[model samples]
Structure formats: structure tokens, C-alpha cells
Target: MATLAPQAPWAMRLVTDRRPIGPPSYAAVTLDASTQRARYTDTAGQVVKMGEHGTNQTNPTTSMSGGGDGAEPQPQTADDSTPDYSSD
Candidate 1:
């Protein structure tokens, strides 16, 4: 006999539209294996069902053309000049 493995849930934020104007909270998501549908459960134990408008994955507003916000800052090189401690 084979045992079925448990499904791992992921984090998701619900939004009414692409602008993300809705409840300011994140939910834990788990996809149904048989239905292949996603279920969202918020911290308050509320299960949100799909609305008549349906759902769409929104694209990120920010651009990552050059590493976006997390780009590492370039390090500055130290000057090779020796210390000028000889004050007259």
C-alpha cells in the first residue's frame, strides 16, 4: 500500500483587482489535488470563494531591468595614496 503525501500550503494576498485594492491581509493557500483548484484561508479562519468576476494573476508593478530594488551597491575602491601625517 502507498500513502499519499501531504500538500504544502503557500502564502497569497487576495485582491479585488489588478490594483490590489481590498483587505490588507495575506492568506495561506492550498491547491486541491483532485480539482486542481486553489483554496485560500485567511488568518481569521474565513474561506474566500471565487467571485463571479473570476481571478487573474496580476503582474508586478515594479520592473527588474537592472535587478530592481535588491541590487547590490557597488563597493568603492580605497585610494592608494599614503597617509600625509607630516604636518609642518
Candidate 2:
């Protein structure tokens, strides 16, 4: 149940050569367990699917709630520091 995020602007993608390469990447890309899918989109709008979120006893879920890890998502608020462009 580890979430990997880009501290700088880089994301490593293992290419055919089996080497990790990335720079000037994303701010954050979370590997969510809700849908049991691992996917991420970078600053260049490239969607990458690594793998699926496997099942584990540490993160049990009810059948009714789907395959979520039973952890509630934290609420996120809009960044008021940024300027609004509704007029535009």
C-alpha cells in the first residue's frame, strides 16, 4: 500500500532496454487500489498503465464496496491561490 509520487519533475518508465528514464515529469501520480488498476498521466498527457492493484490481507474490502482497499479518500479543496479565469 505504497503511493509513489514525483518529488521533482520526473517519472521513470522501464523501456525495452530495461532502463529507468524520466525527467521533467509530473507532480503526483497515485497508484490507486479502488479499481485495482495502475495508471498514470504525465505532464505531456501520456497515460501509462503499470499493473493492477493486487489483493492483500492488509487491505481488505467488502464485496459491496467493490475492490477498494477500505480506505476513505481524503477530500481535496480548490487552490484559491490560483487565479480564476471564468471571465475569459
Candidate 3:
């Protein structure tokens, strides 16, 4: 998912087609500076034409503050060979 701009008349966010079917039709895409990854969208009104694209856009400061990716964090593993001295 991507946001049009951090702040602007259209600060709308969008979910991109990660796996586009055929050749890309020059769908307006933007690169999120914070993530260093490009964000796109197949939904209309979200994407724009070339040259009409915006720049210097970034993710909202609180984009992920509400909650993480919604995935639980993985637990750290212990050294199988090491004994549990703490129990003693």
C-alpha cells in the first residue's frame, strides 16, 4: 500500500497491485522515502499519469503507530546446546 503524499490536496493512501498481470501500463507510482520502496495502486483515482506524479512524498508520522503490520512478533529462540542455568 502507498500514500499519494505525506501532505497535500490528495494525501490519500492506496493498496498497489504487487503482482501486476501483464506489462505495466505506466501506472503512476511513487517511492516512499522512509521505506525506500515504491507504492502503487490499481484502484482508480489513486494513480496518476506520468509527469503528473508527485515527489518528495513520505509516510505519515503515525502510519504504523496505531499498530504494526497486524502480524505477531516472532519469539526469540534459545541455544539448544546451552543449559537453563536460570532454573538452578
Candidate 4:
């Protein structure tokens, strides 16, 4: 007889309650799993569930993008006398 593995639970819901106050237009949110629930805290730090929550995978990529002109920094050459502190 073979034993079956346990099934995984449903994904959590990502809730966006309100818009962020600072720059970079972010949202105040919370993630509530199927087996567990999460509460959002207000400006006064009171926990409450005010907005609708849903299960949605936002970004699939977990890696950071190469920012700043989208160009990799050129490696220093041996002829460059910037300073070879490696000898120290």
C-alpha cells in the first residue's frame, strides 16, 4: 500500500485597501491565505478588514531589474591607474 501526500492549500488573497501617501503610487495591502486571514491596520493602528481581497499572483519574476540607463558598468582595465588596492 502507498501513502498519498497531503494536498496544498489555496493561495492567499492580495487585498488593496487604499492608495499610498508617498511617491511611487503604491497601495496599502494585505495577503490573507485560504487557511489563514489577515487584518489591515488603519492610520491609528487599528486592525480592520475594509477592502475586498482576491487571489492573484502579481509579479512572476523575483529578480531585480538592471537599473540606471540599462547598461552594465564597464570593467576597469589594467592600464587604468585609478588605484590597485589589491596589493595592499
lDDT of 3 by residue, 13-44 (tens): 45456885896655557787999966664547
**Candidate 1 lDDT, tens digit per residue, 1-88?**
9998875554333423567568745477888799998777788768776545444444333322333345686544433434333222
The candidate 1 region of ten consecutive residues with least summed lDDT is: 59-68
Clashing pairs in 4: none
Candidate 4's residue-wise lDDT over 1-88, tens digit each? 9998875554423445586677422234455576466556665655665555555433332333333453676543343223222221
Give candidate 2 regions above 4 Å deviation. Answer: 1-27, 44-46, 51-88
Evaluated at residue 53, the lDDT of candidate 2 is 50
Runs with alpha carbons beyond 4 Å of true place in candidate 3 = 1-26, 43-88
RMSD of each: 23.2, 23.5, 23.9, 20.2
Extract clashing residue pairs from model 1.
none
Q: Candidate 2 lDDT, tens digit per residue, 4-73?
A: 8756434434334566777734544766689875557776657765555564333233233223345775
lDDT of each: 0.56, 0.51, 0.50, 0.48
> What global local distance difference test value does model 3 have?
0.50
TM-score of each: 0.29, 0.20, 0.21, 0.19
User: By lDDT, highest first, what's the ranking?
Assistant: 1, 2, 3, 4
Off by over 4 Å in 4: 1-35, 53-88
